[model samples]
Target: MSFDQLASELQVRKAASLYRGRKVLQSPQQPEVVVDGKAYLAFCSNDYLGLANHPAIVSAFKQAADEYGVGGGASSLVSGHSFHHHALEEELAAFTGRPRALLFSNGYMANLGTVNALLGKQDAVFQDRLNHASLLDAGLLSGARFQRYLHNDVDSLTQRLSKTQARRSLVVTDGVFSMDGDIADLPAICDVANHHKAWVMVDDAHGIGCLGKTGAGCAEHFGLSEQQLPILMGTLGKAFGTSGAFVAGSDVLIETLIQHARTYIYTTSMPPAVAAATRVSLKLVQTEQWRREQLTSLIQRFRRGCEQLGLSLMDSPTPIQPIMIGNADKAMAMSAALRDKGLFITAIRPPTVPHGSARLRVTLSASHTEVQVDRLLDALDQVK
Candidate 1:
C-alpha cells in the first residue's frame, strides 16, 4: 500500500509496454465514431447486429424513461423490481427457451453471483484457462477447489473432473471466448460433464444474438439443451445492443441463486428504462435475421481480405476477428498507424493475451457497409 511501491509498479508496467489507456468516444456506439475530437472509421465494437443505435431501441428507451424515470430506485427484493424488469425477465426466459431467467445488473455480477451461489468449500469448479477474468475471479472467491483445464481441451477437463473428490463439481467456460474469439466445444464439454456428473455453466456473453439460427447463442448454435447445459449466462450489452445480463436455467436453479447470490441481493437493480429498451432489442434480435446475414457477409469479406493481405488472423467465425501482432510495442505502433489512417482499432496488449501475443482486435457490425470494411482493409494494408 505504500506510494513508492505503487509508483514503482506503474513504472514497471510502462517499461514493459503494458500500460493501457482509454479512448474518449464522442459519438454513439456504431461503425463510425468520433474519438478525442477526431472522426474515425471504427472497427472495434461489440455491437454485432448493430441495434445499439437503432431508432426503435432509442425510442423505447426514451418512452420508458418518461414513464419510469431513471434508476430502478432500489434492489429487487426491496422494491426496485418494476413491471419493466419483470416483463423483460419473462421475455428473456421465453427467448432463451428456459424454464426461467433471472436478470443481473451486468455480466460480471451475473457470473460472480451465480458461481458463488452454487459452489461452496466442499465443491470443485473446473474452468477453461482462457475463460474471462470475471469467471476466474468468481471461481477463486467461491471458496471451492478451483482447477483450470487446458483451453478447450476436453481430455484435460475430463481428466481433472474424474479425479475430483468434492461433493459437487461444476465446469464453466465462455461460449465465445472474448479475446481469441474461438468458440467453446460445448457439446463435447457437456458429454464429459455428463460422464462425471458435473454441471456445466456457459457464459455466452459474446455468442448470444450473434450465433444460432434464431440467435439463442452457442447452446442453440450447437443444439445443446437446458438439461445438458444447466447454467446459462449472457450479457445484453454485446450483440443484444443493450445493458445488463441474465442467467437462464431450471426454476430450481434460479430460485437457488435468488436466495443465496450475495451480489444480486446486495446490488441495486439496473435502470428499468434499460430493461425496457432491451425488450425491444431482443425482439429485433429474433425477428431481424437480415442483420445477422449482413454481419456474416461482412465477416467473410474481412477474413478473405485479411487472408489475401497475409495478415495473421485468428480462427474465429464470429464478428470478432483479431489480427495478431506478436509484440506489445509493435501492436501499439500498428494501432497508432491505423489511427493515423483514420481507422480507430484498438491494440490489445499483454496480460490480456499472453505476453507475446498482443493483437489488433478488429470487430465488425451489421451497421457497417462493404465500403467501410474495404476502407478498413486499405488501412490495414497501408499500416502493415
Candidate 2:
C-alpha cells in the first residue's frame, strides 16, 4: 500500500475514535503505578495473584542472572534450552497432571504454533466467537476451514460440528474469556467434542494460578482431566508473574508441536532468568493460598459496591469485572474521568469488543487491600 493510503487509514481510525495508544509505565506491575510521570491507583493489571513484584521473585531473577546471564542465546533446538526451562516444563506437566509440556516464548506464539501444528487445509477448526484474537488469527493462518460458534454456547458448537466434513476437526476455546471475564462451560464443550470425535484445545492463559484448588487452571476448576482436555495452554506472565507460555498435553502432542510448530522452532527462547523466576512464582502460587483468598474477598467487595451503584456489570466471577458502557465516546470519557480521580482503568473499545459494548475493564489483584477497593468504588461513583 502507498504511504498516503496508510495515512488516510490512520485518519479514518482517529475519526471513529478507534485509534489506540499506550501509556509508558515507569513502575512495576502493582496496584499503583507511575505512567508518563503521573501516579495512579491501577485496577487494570493482569497480576491477579500480585506476585509480579514479590521479593522472592525478584531475588530469583537476580540470582539466575548471575548464574545464566541474560538471554537464552539460541533457539531450544540449537542449545537454548537451559536447565531452568527444562525443569519448569517438567514441573508444569506434573502440576497439570499431563504427560508432558512444551514452553513457548509467549502466549501468542504458543497459540499460533499449537493451532498451525495441529490443523491444515484439509481440516476444520471450530472456535468460540469470543476466543482471543491470537486463537482466531492462528485458525485463519493454519489454512483450515475456520468457523466460530456463539460464545459459550455448546449447542451452537454442536450444530456446526455435526455438519463438518473435514479430514480432521478441532474445537478451540478460551477457558476463561479474556474480555468478558466469564468462564467457559468446559464440561459441556468437552462432552460435545468427545461425541463428535474431535479434539478440544483450551488456552487457559487467564485462568491459571487463579482458578481451581491447585492452580491447575480451568481444567482443574471444572474437574476435567487431561483425557477430556487433550490440549491446554497457560501463560506465566499473568498470575505466575513472569514471562513465557506453555502448552501441556500428551507426550505425542508436545513432540508434534516441537517438530511442526514454526513459532516454537524458529523463535529465540525466553530469557533463562525469566524461567528461574517463574519457578519461584510457581512455588508461591501453590504455597500461598492466602493470596487467592484475599483476591476473592476483594472481588466480592468490589462487586457488591458496583451493585449498590447500579453499574452494568457482566456475569463474571473472575477478577476481570467490566462495567458496560454502551458507546465509544462514553467509555473513553468514563476512563478519563476515573483517571482524573486518580484511578487507572482502561476503556476497552471495539474492535477489542463488539460495537456498543465498550466498557471499563476493572481488574483485582491479591495485593489489593479492602480500603483500596473501597477507594476505587468511591472514585467510580464520583466519576460516573
TM-score of each candidate structure, all chains considered together:
0.99, 0.99
Error of 1 at 263 (Å): 1.1
Least accurate stretch of 10 residues (summed lDDT) in model 2?
A: 1-10
Question: Which regions in candidate 1 have their CA more than 4 angstroms from the true location?
Answer: none
| RMSD (Å) per prediction | 0.8, 0.9
Score residue 102 of candidate 2 by CA lDDT: 97
Question: What is the TM-score of candidate 2?
Answer: 0.99
Per-model clash counts, in order, read 0, 0
Give the lowest summed-lDDT range of ten residues in model 1.
1-10
Candidate 1: deviation at residue 77, Å?
0.5
Runs in model 2 lying further than 4 Å from the true structure: none
Return model 1's CA RMSD, one decimal.
Answer: 0.8
